[model samples]
Target: MINGILFRQRTGLPWRDLPACSGSWKTVHDRHRRWSADGTWERILRAVQADADTEGRIDWSMVSVDSTTCRAHQHAAGASTRAPKIPGRRRSPARHRSDEALGRSRTRPDHVGGDKAYSSRRNRRHLRRRHIKHTLPEPRDQRANRQRRGSQGGRPTGFDKTIYRRRNEVERTINRFKNFRAVATRFDKRA
Candidate 1:
């Protein structure tokens, strides 16, 4: 049943339009929803990730964390104002927009490279916990905050300028992922 759902997600098929050959689509969809609600999906994903780590599929020596905005149709927009847009057109008639769609995790080849948007304390802490080398530029707000606090603010975290150049690959990867119609359209109703 779970496999059917995975297939639907990979193929970007409407839930109601799932093929009969895959078995009862309703059963699969229901199971998927139930698992999501119960946090079973998260646990499964974590387990697989852990297993991959143990088997060496994951390179903890370097990992990247970045977010991409998957633009949605005006009809798909939610109640958020900062959502992705259609671009080029001047007017936007959508009532609500969300900037975030789905998040995908990837293993960085050597070191994680990101911009100021990823400079949050929590993100830095996560990288530290994973023991992954990273370079994330500081945001203007954080810099000002540190300056205002003087010695109390402590020194800003060191960021590698050379490694940060590699951050361009993150954007390239996002572009490649978006090449898939399913990813671009966000046909999967489930997160």
Candidate 2:
């Protein structure tokens, strides 16, 4: 099952078109659905991350964060909706987000770099709480809001041009990852 999913990720195959090398496509789909519902994928991703950290592959001295929208196929929309909604629930998850696994840890980076999308107060506070210096430019709206509040608006957060230069590392990483046709092509229906 694992090999099938990894193959899909590598080969950009439609889930229904998963090769029979491992098992029936139905079995792979069933397993993927069950794992998605049970947070198994989250656990697996975190485990891989932890292993990388343990192997000294993670450098908390510098890190960056950004989000990208993956265009979804129209056919993908109905899968979650067809599932029975919980009592009193209003809507299906646009994208499921699961909890961090036990033992998951985020080290304090010497410097953090991100774009305007990450320039929210809550994100800044979280980084500050960890004592991680950040170089994200304040958005124009946030600046205006702060100025409007006068003394009540805390001082503008610090920004460092030099540190921000390292933000390209994350962009490059994304480009490299997307160089794989499967990743770039959005073969998986889900985010």
Candidate 3:
């Protein structure tokens, strides 16, 4: 059942298209759905993360963040108005995000590395308030405007060339996720 479920998930196949070797696709689908609703998947992830942390395989010192646009299918829109809305399901999850699993962690990362797109004064202020170190390169326009302000602009934001290089870790992580068909295609309408 697990294999069947994983296969379906990996391939992003419709429930009806699942192979017969899986033995009744409905059963596998139901099991996956039930497990998902019961927080089994989240539990599994937490357990694995715990094990990795214990083994010193997971680093907690720094958190890398980057953005990548996920292209949606042309058919993503045009949903049937006749269908009832699912309560608690967000309208546009891709645009509107909620607190993620990492946000729930008790331990805060000491540092954050992000892309230039995330380089905003508000973001830096928030990070300062949180007392977390960040490595986000300021955009060219921001630099020019800051320079235009002269003394009022204050000193340039402290950026480390060495630390910024590590920012690519998040970009690589995003690329890895894109290897999954569902993530690359954005087949689902909601997210």
* Highest-lDDT candidate: 3
Ordering by TM-score: 3, 2, 1
For model 3, what is the error of residue 190's alpha carbon versus the real structure, in angstroms, after optimal superposition?
6.6
Give the poorly placed runs of model 1, Cα more than 4 Å off: 71-112, 120-133, 138-162, 165-191
Give the per-residue lDDT digits (tens) of candidate 1, residues 1-191: 76687677667667787788778888888897799789887677666655665565654434445666555444443434554443421221211111121222443334666677778879878877876667888888898999899999877878776667656655676666656555556544234
User: How far is each candidate from the true structure, as Cα RMSD in Å?
Assistant: 9.6, 5.7, 4.9
lDDT for each candidate structure? 0.62, 0.69, 0.70
- Stronger candidate by TM-score (1 vs 3): 3
Model 3 ranges with Cα > 4 A deviation: 74-106, 188-191
lDDT of 1 at 162: 67
Q: Itemize residue pairs with steric clashes in candidate 1.
A: 83-98
Best prediction by TM-score: 3
After aligning candidate 2 to the native by TM-score, how far in Å is the CA of 184 from where it should be?
5.9
**How would you encode candidate 2's per-residue C-alpha lDDT over 31-137 as one tens digit per residue?**
87789889888788777877776666777777777654444434444436656532321222121112245443554567778899789899889888978788889
| TM-scores of the models, in the order given | 0.56, 0.69, 0.76
